[model samples]
Target: MTLLEVEGLRVKIRTEGGEVTIVDGVDYAVEPGQVFGVAGESGSGKTISVLALLRLLPRGATTSGRALYGGRDLLRLSGRALRRVRGRELAMVFQDPLTSLHPMMTIGRQLSEHVRIHEGLSRRAALARASELLAEVRIPDPKRALEAFPHQFSGGMRQRVAIAGALATRPKLLIADEPTTALDVTVQAGILRLLDRLRRESGLSVILITHDLGVMSSIADHVSVFYAGRIVESGPPPELLSAPRHPYTRALLDALPHPEAEGRGELQAIRGLPPSPRNRPPGCAFHPRCAYATEASLEQVPLLRPVGERRLLACHVDPFAPGP
Candidate 1:
């Protein structure tokens, strides 16, 4: 069963010039217990797409399309109806724990408050629940740790608290945007492990948005490569990572540092910059930077179509074709 199905999800915001499309015709599904990863460079609309589902987009922004969660259209939901779904059924963990967590409020207070609101538990009960949540995230001495403020804990610990807060309501689906960003290598590994374990233990589905292909390869069952507010390619991690069907996905992999090439060669960088949402190029957005771009790529947008088993590609050039 699918936990969430987003189709033709478009987000536009009014600018001085006119309304600019930030997310254009994005579509995907998150099955129960699946880690659906959205990967791309910055400004690819990965973060804002998820924000649209939560209705957390900035004022004056308009979102179109269907975000069907548990058979209900999240986009069409009223404020009160959406509030019922936000914490209890769907929750989000942001990139920066410092900004997400309250600096002045004790960790317990923050966690307990969420539980009290969503679960309707009394203060004492909520505190106990909060303590358990901290322990679940592997916070040391969780009971006492809860009394400490966000600043008292290390960066990783603060992130764990942020994860715990999102899980306080036992949400079925979690959207983690750059959850491991800014942490050290070991801390990043730990956070990734924590999320994987949580998914395994609770059958929780996740929409993980990040630019880290390493992170996606490590934990994501499926991956979507985003570019210029659209998905360029998507498939299971093994096939998608090992042999990308889209030029952009290929370029991204080539840009990753290879251990064997550590001393032999420099990391390859993708040429050209991502287009601004307001002035996106016609046809394929990645054509300017793509090595395989052809005349067709500049003429019309390629629809995301199935090219292989469980794989989707949006490009004029087929990487698997016999001739150039």
Candidate 2:
């Protein structure tokens, strides 16, 4: 079932000079019990796009779009209505656990407050739910752990607590923004496994936002590749990794260091910095650095189009046949 559908989602900030568009005409949808991954490099608008949907953009930022969830437009919800929907029907795990968690509040207090406000549970019942949630996230001695503060747990454990709190109300959808970015590799793996397991057990749909393709591919059933303020391509991992149809998509895949090519050459990297929001290049934003750019590409923006079932691409130059 389609749980969320976002269309023509655009964001612009009132800058010193003028309004600078951050994300432009980005669209995607998430299904129930499916893991939909949004992947890109830093400043690719991956984070902002999701943030805009939740009406979490900074003050003075404007968002125009339709985010249909449960027969309502989430973008049009009032503050109180949105709050009612946010943690109860939908939840989010932010990028930094340290910053997202309240250092002053006890873990138990934080988690219980989340439940009491959303579920209308009594203090004792909410505390019991918090303990159960901590256990579900596999925190060692969950009951004892609840009494400790956020700082007492390691980075990975803190994230687990965040995840547990998000899941406390049994939300239908969870948005995880760079959940593993701050952890060590081993800890990152554990968190990934934990998310996958939770989805399996609860039938919870997820939208995981990250710049790491490897991380997304490991857990996401489908992936959307975002470029400067837009999605350049999207598909299943096998279709995209095997035969990407856009120049930018191909370049991103070629840049990965494969174990088969460990002794072949130095790791490839995409040259040129991402465009500044205020001064993006005209036409295709990537045309300046694209290997197959042409005069046509320099003058026209390619709209995202389907090349196959469940696959999309946006590039003037074809992967198999470069434009003249």
Candidate 3:
């Protein structure tokens, strides 16, 4: 079942000069117990799309289009109604644990407070639940860690705690933004394993947003490649990873380091920086950096077209098309 659906979603930030579009007409859906990955370079509007769903965008930012969660329109919800949904029905594990964690508060207090608010549990009960959550996320000695401050934990541990907090309420949907970015390889693997286990055990839907295509391939059931505020392609992980139809998606996959190809040559990196939201390209946003772009691509934007079952690509020239 589809637990969350976002259609034609557009987000613009108001500035002194004019409106700068950050998320442009993106569409995606997440089903129960499915991990939908949103992959893109920095400034591709990955975070903004999640923020828009929670109505957490900063001042002067405007969002339009439908965000339906459980058949209710999230965009139309009042602040109070939204608050009731957040942390209980839908929760977010932020990119930075330190930023999300209150420095002055103990880990126990932070976790318990959320439980008390959302679950209306007693302090004692909340603390017990918090301890279980910490252990569930694979933290060592949950009792001792509860009294520790955010600074006391390592980067990986802090992120685990953050994930614990998000799962405290056993939310139906979890949005994890760059959940493993700051961790080492070992820690990243551990975190990913824990997330996979938790999702299976709890049957929780997830939205995993990151720039790492390898991570997405491993964990995501469905994948969406975003470039300059728009989703250029989306499909099941195997299809998208094995035979990416969009140029941008192929570029990302090629950029991944391959130990087998070590002796071949230097690693490939996508040339040029992501375009500024204030000055996006006229037609296809990625044409400025796309090697395959031609004059035809520069003249018109391509809407997502069906390439196969559950696969869509937004590109003028299909990579899978027969050669001349």
Candidate 4:
């Protein structure tokens, strides 16, 4: 079943020069108990897209879209209506727990407060639930950890707390934006495992956003490749990994470090930086960096259209098309 659907989601921020669009015409859906991955490099509008869709953008930003959750348009929801739905139905765990978590509050206090607000439990019950949540996230000695402050916990522990808080109300959909970005390799694996287990055990849908293709390959059921404020390709993770059809997606995969290429000196990388939002390149934004670009591809933007069963690509040229 579809848990959330976003269509034509556009976001703009008031810049020094004027307003500029950051996310343009993004569309995707999350299904029950599925892990949907949004992958892209930094400045590709991945984070801003999700934040704007959830009405969580900071000041000077605005969003427009039909984000349907449970058949209701989230964009049209009143602040109060949205608040009622946010934590209980759709929760978010941001990239950095240190900044997202309150330093002054004890771990127990933070989690219990969130539990009480969304679940309407008593102070005593909420506190007990908070400890249970800590256990759920596999934190050792949950009760003792609750007595500590945000800064008292290690990076991995703090991220666990953030996950526990998001799962407090058993939200149907959890948006984890770059959740493992700050963790060490080993710890990053553990966090991804926890999220995958939660989805399997609790039937919780998750939208895991990150720049790491390795992480997505391991945990994501389906994946979307975002670039230059648009989706370039989307399909089952296995398919996208084995047979990426878009030039940008191909470049991204080729850029990953290979164990066999150890003696190759410098690792492969995509040339040129992603275009700045304020100074977006004309036509297909990726044409500047693409190896297969042609004269036709430089002057026209491509719509994200279906190219196969459950697969879509937005590009002027098909990498797998029959040769002349």
The best candidate by TM-score is 1
Ten residues in a row with the worst lDDT in model 1? 315-324
User: Once superposed on the true structure, which residue ranges of model 2 sit more than 4 Å away at CA?
Assistant: 321-324
The lDDT per prediction is 0.92, 0.88, 0.90, 0.90
**Candidate 3 runs further than 4 Å off:** 322-324
Better of 2 and 4 by lDDT: 4
Tell how far residue 296 is off in model 3, in angstroms. Answer: 2.9
User: After aligning candidate 4 to the native by TM-score, how far in Å is the CA of 25 from where it should be?
Assistant: 0.6
- Against the true structure, what is each candidate's TM-score? 0.97, 0.96, 0.97, 0.96
Off by over 4 Å in 4: 260-266, 322-324
Clash count for candidate 4 is 0
Please, what are the lDDT tens digits per residue for candidate 2 over residues 1-324?
A: 699999999999998899999998888889988899998888989899988777889998999989999999988998789998888888899999988899999999989997999879999999999999999999999889889999999999999999999988999999999999988989999999999998899899999998777887788988999888999889987777677787777777778878875588776688888898888888889998888889878898889888778988887777553245
User: How does candidate 3 score on lDDT?
Assistant: 0.90
Note the residue pairs that clash in candidate 2: none
Error of 1 at 23 (Å): 0.2
Worst 10 residues of 2 by lDDT: 315-324
Q: What's the lDDT for candidate 1?
A: 0.92
Q: How far in Å is the alpha carbon of 169 misplaced in model 4? A: 0.7
- CA RMSD per model (angstroms): 1.4, 1.9, 1.4, 1.6
